[model samples]
Target: MTWNSKLRCFFLLWVLNSNIILASLESEVSAQSDVKDHGEHDNEDYSLERAGSFDQIFKIQQTYLTVQVDQLNSTNTPRAKDEKRRLLKELSRAHGKWGDQHPRKKLLDALFSYSRYFERNIPDVNRWRQLYNHVSSKHKRLLDRTVSYTKKFDRAESLLRQNHFLCEDVVNEALSYYEIGREELRKHIADAEKAGIVADKMSVSQSLKHIGRDWTDDGVSERDGAFPCILDSIQSLFPNRQSSRYKVLLPGSGLGRLGYDVAALGGFEVTNNEVSAYMNIMYRFIETQSKKDAFQVYPFVDGWSHHVTQDDMFYQLSFPSMTMNNSNVILVEGDFTTVFKDSKDKFDVVITHFFIDTARNLMSYFETISSLLAPGGYWINFGPLLYGTGPWVQLALDEILTVTEDMGFQFVDGPESCGSLTFPDKKVRNKEAAYGYSPRALTKNAYHAQSWIARR
Candidate 1:
């Protein structure tokens, strides 16, 4: 027991205790960081209050949950570690309030029920919707959840059916939705099974083979009507234009709704040019069936902003079929770039909605649109530059204006900002919802769009 030995022993003991304390502190810091990263801080309440209303709060909460889970899953390795660190830094700043757990699970339940209805004839959609809507409005989260999950499950199902590799979580979620509602949606399920109607087996046109499921519910025309300033300007300018003599061309007229609107004015021979056979078929079906009161189509359901309900699940598209002045309406099935290139007749006007950006060479649109229009006739356009991955470059506002002017057209008005609306119903405006797919962030919804009325 010399002094040197005692000193060495003391040093060893101190080092051991210090290392243990450091390790424990690091572990505790990591745990706190995880909770904070999720904004589920132990100390703070992130309850539904921050969102103003219960529904709003529920959406915010659900979005956070969905996004957080997605981020964790989608990012692994260095990025994942970085994200975890970012979460920790964010959490260290504040506490969260916990409201009664948002009804995220209820959404899954409702989606399972609604999706089961798809197993039967189309009318069964309304039947299932009626029962599902009977739930209290307070639980609207259920419907919203249904929209979110339906798409996820749809994608999952599509991949599985195609024999594509599926993720474990996606497969589990799909199975849960498929099987969970056997008891809850029992009657609908039974009715579906007895009816022996399968949505997958139903015969559809070749054009609709894989992706036309949602075209019939295409509400773009309804939304296009929201551009009153643009539409009004065109109508006023062309009021004196002869009805029988003046021809209107709508290139990229998806399902012909917007073009129908123009033809229904009864002043122009409107020709709807569409490349997709699915849309052409739908346009004809809507026009031919206009003799009926209303045409119903089953569209895949999803949304972010509106209260989710089974009522929101499908579209009962209304056509002013009985009253519509559609004698001048015609359908031309072909690509716009080459469709009318050889035609001897020219048009009095060419108007487009959401079509310009679809062009492989956007500048070329000016040549086509101008060629279609008569001298001093108008070319009015509306739509966002929603560029998903594409083969061609997108044109900015200046580029669009320059191209039109260079093509020997006089700019009557825009390339001017007229606030855009995607849905005609004001209730749904600016309400945020996320579809499962993520387009390029920079290109998606860069909707600082303008309406241009140029005269050729």
Candidate 2:
């Protein structure tokens, strides 16, 4: 063989080997990047722990109150009024101490937001009124003050919006006062419990009694209460059925307000599937009370109350099995994405409030809903879409809507305020003027939010 031919052959072989190595390196990098992206997305899917901090605090408070109440319940001797006052004072002091120690603006904001959300959503008017009355007067006063402060803060926000200067010191001072007010208000719940003024379970009879009471008024009315406005919008979408045969399902049904309302609507059989055992037990107790009262009222007001048979209401503390039934309101307890993967039947209407945005897998939730909802069925949901710690790693409203459309649902209506109450700006909007600011542009880094309603 010639020397030139040998050199050319060697160079070509070397070039080919180099290209193969480069391709291999590129593939490895691409795979690693894909894995990293998947991990990041997975981390953002659900924020159960993030959302539960306030719930944990409230639960701890409830535990202490329950223990004290049990002690009081077991006692044969009736305590003097003075002793009651002392107990109340002690409880209030304990709560105040805890609040001072925690001192989390985020926690306070979340609680207030959740309460406001509840006040707008839940369907039952009577239950709403009960919850409003259940809140301590001190809490009410503080909430009122917070609302007023929020309006003032909004003025500053508006000024900022218009690119005007705001005093940062003034804003900070107002926020400080608002925080103090919230702490004081929290103490009121403990104080009330110590005074033996507890808001017990709302029986069906009690709920019915409160119905139609000041329906037009938003001040502690039967329809506007603790659960929120989002829940009510979902309820409104369930067209009235003549027979007590309609079935409803609620996954992640915390405290079961929406589920109970569906059951109360008469013709619908409702199931509340909750992940938390504590929530499940609480819901079951409430449902039992409702059933007992319902049985009592059923005979006299035939057709006034939609008769919900015990068999119609089912609950599972885990994810639902793939079985579908026409008369069943199945509450499946499990990871929402994995549950019903093989389910053959779709719902007439799927209801959710504040559930989708809370999930890191916003797309998965929408896809699951689309799969579960029958053609021409409705998807009724309401909740604030805001950036926060926990499940919501980022605020991507456009991304969310895009995913919803991909899942075959159309945006029906909403982004409207669910209830009569105004958004509290004191929590979200910064008041730079109150806090003392130099003549610099105030960057609007506030969380953007809107309530939505969509249909399939």
Candidate 3:
């Protein structure tokens, strides 16, 4: 009787324990499912119809904003006053249309509000209490613009939080990213003041456009295909990756990611050349001086799409601490052509990406590379021949090749097409249209983005 009662009690306890375990597993799975659903909702791609209909509208609004800003800053004549009134009206209309309902509209409203703040806050002569307290009109204007623009970025971050399309964490990261930039700029300004030079003309705003991209690894999907190709070419030339230490030049190295990778992995002495001041500053900061454990930024941070939720909108970006502190990675800031123009055959490999188009003269680039590389040096190039210069100066791919050949460089490998370049949440395709936009011009006109390895 005791054995039978004990066995029955044990079975009852075992069944109860199994039920509890099943309930916990179900709850865990349900939680994961909820997360997956939120991810999908946030990351949904913009529909074709929505993109086609609204992308043009977004572009128009952006263009209008740019034009209005220009007019506001122009000569202060009667016409200029009228232009200001018109600009304010346009901003009012935009605010009225969507208010905070749309993230992009909210951003525009923030921008317009800041512009008005700038206009109204211009210090008057009477405001100066003492001679030492007096500020130059130029310095006042610059301060007003900087503070106002910084506020706009702050406001944009706030508005973006209201929209479910993007991640608030990412938005905050971007805001912090810009704030860091602003602080870095203050140091530069202080240095300029100490030297008795005007730093207001540095155009900090213009340098911002591409700095975030370089600070993150988000653009790898579009532009990183050539990284492997270039490495392979260089390794083949040397064969012994561990023993051989080759001299490498990365011209127009935006953020110097590829160059950094080459030096770290290929055991090469790499020099990364970037011409833009802000880009170089940010890149160098991340490469050497970034105080943060890891830096994060949204690539193509400005562009927003109607097709996807804010969550799926920005590419989640972070650059790992692969700085290769032990490796010989140099960051040089200057015009690539001019910097290496007088260079002898000092470099074993020269790598260029989305850079050749920045050249005013394509022939100049060829000549510079030829001079910079050794007799058997390899020049690895990726990116289209979009002709950054005027149409008159723009040369076709064939013309570029002919000039390189004339410069005593022969093909080591390929002009092989990697793939068409496309940015995250952007309508523009390829490096050309991304940089320059025209509704009349086709976006995907150039294709078969070939990577070439030319040996001198």
| TM-score-best of 2 and 3 | 3
Q: Candidate 3 lDDT, tens digit per residue, 1-456?
A: 110101111111123422311121111111111222233333333221122222121111110111111112212345334433443453343534654443333322222221122122212212322442476777757866865422433433332222212122222222232222323323433444476643221232223324333333443433344555566656666777677688888888866767766765656888788765445444533543222224343332233333133333333445543332413566655577765554443898888876887787767777788788877888887677666537336776666667677777786544223333333332112222133111122232233444667888
Worst 10 residues of 3 by lDDT: 1-10
Q: If candidate 1 were superposed on the true structure by all CA atoms, what would the RMSD be?
A: 26.5
The digit string of per-residue lDDT tens for model 2 on 62-147 reads 10111121112111123223322432343343444465223232223222222222122222433444566777888878966865
TM-score of 3: 0.49
- What digit string (tens of lDDT, one per residue) describes model 1 on residues 1-456? 110101111111123422311121111111211221222322322211121232111111111111121112111245234433533342231324322121222223222232332232323434545566677775767656765533433432332221111111122233232233223334433444476633231222121221222233333333433445455755777667563456788898765656656655556677778765334433443443322233222232322223244343332333323433345566665678875776776887888767787888776777788777778788877665666566376876666667667778776544222443333422111212122111212222234444656778
Model 2 spans with C-alpha error above 4 angstroms: 1-240, 290-330, 386-393, 414-449
Best model number under TM-score: 3
Q: How high is the lDDT of residue 343 in model 2?
A: 53
| Each prediction's TM-score versus the true structure | 0.46, 0.36, 0.49
